[model samples]
Target: MTTHLITGAGSGIGAVLAQRLLERGDDLVLLARSASRAAELAASYDGARTVVADLADPASVEGLDLPASLDSVVHAAGVVELGAVADLGVASWLEQLTVNLVAPAALTRVALPALRAARGTVVLVNSGAGLTAHPQWSAYAASKHGLKALADSLRTEEAEHGVRVSTVYPGRTATAMQEKVHAQEGKDYDAADWIDPGTVAATILHLLDVPRDATVPDITVRPNA
Candidate 1:
């Protein structure tokens, strides 16, 4: 059975992905800022375990005690702070970059040896903002764009190590984060207009199911408008 470590496993896409992996008989190591939620989810599965780590904190991420080897690592934890460049505070910009970009890179760095040993895959959960910049999403867009770059670089760098890196750029999804974004825009949240988190999880699973010789480096999933 493949062993996978998933960040942001407490809810949304992360939680859905964890459940799907468990259902398929994969062992899971879940990480989240809230220990309670991660612990609760781990308890429901026989071989599942939980790790409490605040991805925004570099020290915390660096200190993670993960398994010696893992078949996959999913970096799904992210924070979105929306505002134009001029009005966005430096702190907010840094926070967005830290959680959305830096943390993933750091976690992947720590997991590199294990990934190499297992010929594993690294999945970065990015967003549509990574490809296009919108008026009020400067900070979020910048971080995601950076994340896209990170994934591309890793794919190239880790190729010889037999470790694959894939980035998923999903459009607005029916997640709590989407609700917060809608509230900030003074718009009502509509699940119909967004992609389902399960759909995205299924896409990741498909990527994993591909032959070891084949690699899908980037995937873009958007709602059908």
Candidate 2:
């Protein structure tokens, strides 16, 4: 069975992806900021293991104990801070970049040896913000854009190791994070206005299903009107 490790498995797209992978008979190692949530998920799944770690902390990521080999590592943990560049505090900006960009890079680096051993795949869950910047979203946009650059660089560098890196850019997925974003925007939260997290999870699964000789490096999933 393929073994996969997923960060942010406590909620949202990460949790949904874990469920999908479990249903498909893959072994999972779930990492989340909430130990209780990760434990609950592991208990529900027959062979899933839980690791509680704050991905924003470099020390926490560097010390992660993982299997010697892994079929995939999905960096689904992220944070967003919305404000015009002039109004956003340096702390908020750094926090957003740390969680949304730096943490993924650090975790991927830690997992590189295991991933290389298995000739595995690395999936970065990015956002449409990575593709375009809008008003009051400067910090978040910059972090995601950095994430896109990270994925692109990793794809090229790891190709020689027979490892594939793919990135999914989803447009406003309906999750707790979307609710937070809507609240910050002073708009009523409407799930209908966003893409479904399951749809994004399905797309990642498709990327993994492709033959080893081929790769779908980048995918964009936008909400339909």
C-alpha RMSD of each candidate structure in angstroms: 1.3, 1.3
Cα-based TM-score, every candidate: 0.96, 0.96
Q: TM-score for candidate 2, please give it.
A: 0.96
Candidate 2: RMSD over Cα atoms? Answer: 1.3
Reference-based lDDT, residue 33, model 1: 77
Clash list (residue pairs), candidate 1? none
Q: Write the per-residue lDDT of candidate 1 for residues 48-67, one digit (tens) a residue.
A: 98877787785687767888
Worst 10 residues of 1 by lDDT: 37-46
Task: Please write out the lDDT profile of model 2 over residues 46-93, one tens digit for every residue.
Answer: 789877778668568777888999999998888887998889999999
